[model samples]
Target: MKYALKRIFMLVLTMVIVSFLTFLAFELISGDPAEAMLGTEATPERLAALREELGLNRPFLVRYASWLAGFVSGDLGVSLRYRQPVWDLIAPKLEITLCLCLASFVLITAVSIPLAIWSYRWTGTVFEAVRTAFNQLCMAVPPFFTGILMTYLFGIVLRLFVPGDFPDLHTRFGEAMVHLFFAAVCLGIPRTAMTVRMMRSTVISEMQKAYVRTAISRGNDRHAVLTRHVLKNSLTSAITFLGQTMAELIGGSVVVEQVFGIPGLGRLLVYSISTRDYPVVQTVVVILAFWVVLAGTLADLINQQVDPRLRLGGAA
Candidate 1:
């Protein structure tokens, strides 16, 4: 209970800091929301009205306070670009982005873990050399590159799947699967390479520990030694990687979404930024920050369980 409470408090503190920084950063940027709304030829009266309408005429601190209050109450305000409630504009797109992130994560873990375990088992061989080469190549290629390659091959030349945008799963699961699978693969390839490398390193490190040596000395089989002693320890590092990946996924999805024309948060964010929609951008940044902090918190809690030194009581 105490640990959970501490986490919640820290989450709140982190959000407060994020909000303050976002506010300050946007304020420093050129172009006011009112000016963006009224245009350069506007009369002073129209400018004053626009400011009053958007509550921009208020003192900075007061405006921040009011906005924060509304945010806490689930009202993120209206977007100047979309002319709709920020949540209304964001919620539908968020679903798609969240699904994309989740799909990428699942695919990454599924492929990386087995390859990592394989790499650990078959260390120092031609197989290991091949794995190293493959991972290195994947690490070198960016997600956008992979996305484009997939689109060109499977989507364009072969005509195996649609090029961009997700399909309706409700009507046709098959087509939806094709779109999602391509997207997931594009996003997951680089992530899988990075994750596999980290997991393999962690597995190697854990296998060299005294506990693992003890298990091996007890006549335990390789499978038993790995499953019983090493997997959990290795996963701690993987979990941390996944959390950081979560943060990157939200931002990185922009490229993939745009390349494919997917209606996701990444595309929405791109649109908002291009139009200088301050409210939409600010709200999205805050939301992304919350997800990032939450992911970190989850990783910390899991790490505490796997590694006793991370616990508050420092249990062994």
Candidate 2:
């Protein structure tokens, strides 16, 4: 309970810092939201009035405080570009990005674990060598590159889906899922490869520990010992990596969304940044940072539960 509370506190602090830094960085950058919004019609009077209306003319700390307070109260401010409430702009996109990340995570976990175990079981065999090579290849290739290949292979060549023609996520939910699934595959390949390598290595390392030899000496079946003991111990590290992977998937999905022309938060973020829509950009960035921090916090808590040693160490 205490550890969880401490982590929760840290999570809040981290978010505060992230939000402040994001706000500060945007303030430092060269771009006038008012000018961007008014574009060719941005006269001196119009720019001044718009800045005043948007509270952009306020002191940095005051604007930051107002934005932060509004965010805490569920008011995400209005987008300068869209001229709509920021929440309204991002909510649907958030769902799409979440679905994409979730799909990629599911793919990574579903494929990596079995492949890792199989490769471990078949150590030194031809299958293991082939699997190793495949993992290496997957890891070497970036997600965006994989996304392009998948787009060409599945979208263009196979006619599985149209390239850069994403279905309306709201109206064509099923078809949208199918499109996201393919994009997820692109994001998952490299992460899955990484997880397999890590899991296999950890399992191998655990197998060489003293307890494994002791269990086998006591007439425990090697396979049974592996399933009951080694796998559990090996998963601690894998869980940690998966948490980090989850955060990476969020960031990586941006590129994948762009490659596939999906209207997810990542895509929105890119557009928002380009348009100097600070409300949308700030909100999106802070939300992404929150997810990243939350993922790590959850992983840390889970690790402590999985390994008592970590709990004790944390307490100390």
Candidate 3:
């Protein structure tokens, strides 16, 4: 409980820093929100009024303090684009993004673990070369490129799935699943390649340890040696990578979401950024930062439980 509290406190501190940096970066940008909102035809009086309304006329520190206070109170401010509460704009989309990220994560983990196991089991030969080649190809490509290729081949050319919108999972479960199936595959490919490579390397290295040889010499089967010992010792880095991958999911899925026209947080983020919707952008960035911190905390806790050595490895 005490450790958890400490982790939570650190997360709060990190969020504060993230919020400050986000606000500062946006403020440093050249464009004025009022000008962006009202266009070139905006009069001086109209711009002044808009600034005052949005609290943009206030000093930077004052605006920051107010923004922080409101954020702590669950008020993320009003969106200039939608003229609605930014929190409301994001709330429904949040679940969609969470589902997508989670689905991608699941795909990555599922594919990576099995691939790693297989590669380790089938080391040294043409099959291993094939496995390595596949992983390398997947890892070499970017997510955006993958998304575009998938969309062109699947959506534009073949017309296999709808082009855009939050897929209707309730009624069109199979179709929705198929759409996300491709999206998850694209999102997971690079991540899975990286993860499988890391796990395979780690497992191979762990297998070289003295205890592994002792177990093998004792007539332990391959499965027992791999699962009971090698995997247990090798998964620490994998868990850490999984945590980092969770953080990357938000940003990496942007291209995938845009290609699919999915109403996930990534798409919303791109929209907000393009429109210079400060409240929405700020809220989303802060939320993403909180998620990253949360992922790291959870990973640390889980790793500590699974491997006692991790307790002394510092909170990452």
Candidate 4:
């Protein structure tokens, strides 16, 4: 209970810091948002009036406090570009990003974990060598490159899915997933390479530990030992590794989303940034930061459960 509480507190603190830094960084950016909004008509008096209306003329701390308060109360403010409630705009876009990320994560975990276990058993064999080389090549390939290739081969040549057919998940969940699956594949492949490699190495290393040797000396079957003890123990590192990689997954999905023309948070963020729509950009960034922090927290809790040594008041 205490450990979970500690993690929850840290999560909230991390979010507060993230929100503050997000606001502060935008405040520090060179351009004037009000000027950008007004454009050619942004004369001195007009710009000042617009800034005051948007509360941009207020002291930095006061504005941040007001924004933060509104944020906590679920009022994320309005989008300067869309001229709509930020929540209304983000709510739909967020569904797409979340579905993409979730699908990619599922693909990564489904492939990587089993591949790692299989490769661990075949270490130094011809198959292992080929698998390692394949993963290395995949890792070398950037997400955008992979996305382009996938788009060409699947979208253009095979016509497996349309490049810009990202349907609204809310209205067409089935059809939407068909298009999202391809985009997710492009986003997940490189990350799957990293995860598989990490899992294989960690399992191999765990097999050489003193505890494994002790279990073997107690007459446990080698296969049983590796399956029940070694793999379970080794997944701790892989889980932590995957958790850390969640940020990359999100970042990479941004590029993949563009290549595939998915209307995800990444695409929205790019559009928002280009249009000087600070509210939308900041909201997307803050939401992403929250996911990263939550992933880390979940990884920690799982690690504690996996290894008794990590549990509070448990074996050292």
- Residue-pair clashes per candidate: 0, 0, 0, 0
Clashing pairs in 3: none
Poorest lDDT segment (10 consecutive residues) of candidate 2: 307-316
Q: Which is the better candidate, 2 or 4, if ranked by lDDT?
A: 2
Error of 4 at 244 (Å): 1.0
Please list the residue runs of candidate 4 whose C-alpha ends up more than 4 Å from where it truly belongs after superposition: 43-45, 313-316
Instruction: Give the per-residue Cα lDDT of candidate 3 at 106.
Output: 92
Q: How do all models score by TM-score?
A: 0.93, 0.94, 0.89, 0.94
Which structure is stronger by TM-score: 3 or 4? 4
Model 4 poorest 10 in a row by lDDT? 307-316
Better of 3 and 4 by lDDT: 4
What is the C-alpha local distance difference test score of candidate 1?
Answer: 0.84
> For candidate 1, lDDT tens digit of each residue in 1-316?
4666687789899999999899888888948788887788999889998888888877989988988999999899999977899988998788778878888878887888988899888797889889899899998898888888888998899987777656765576678667767777888788888988999999988888999888989999999999988997788889889888877777778788777667788888888899999889998999899989988888777777777666764233
Give one digit per residue, the lDDT tens place, for model 4 in 1-316.
5777788899999999999999999889837887888887668999898888888878999989999998888889888887798989998878888888888998998899988888887887899888888999989988788888888898899987788877778787887898888888888888899898888888878888999989999999978898889988988898888888776678778888899989888888898988989998888889989999999998888888888777764234
For candidate 3, the 10 contiguous residues with the lowest summed lDDT are 307-316
Q: By the lDDT metric, which is better: model 2 or model 3? A: 2
Leading candidate by lDDT: 2
lDDT of 2 by residue, 65-99 (tens): 98899999989999888889999999989999999
TM-score head-to-head 1 vs 2, winner: 2
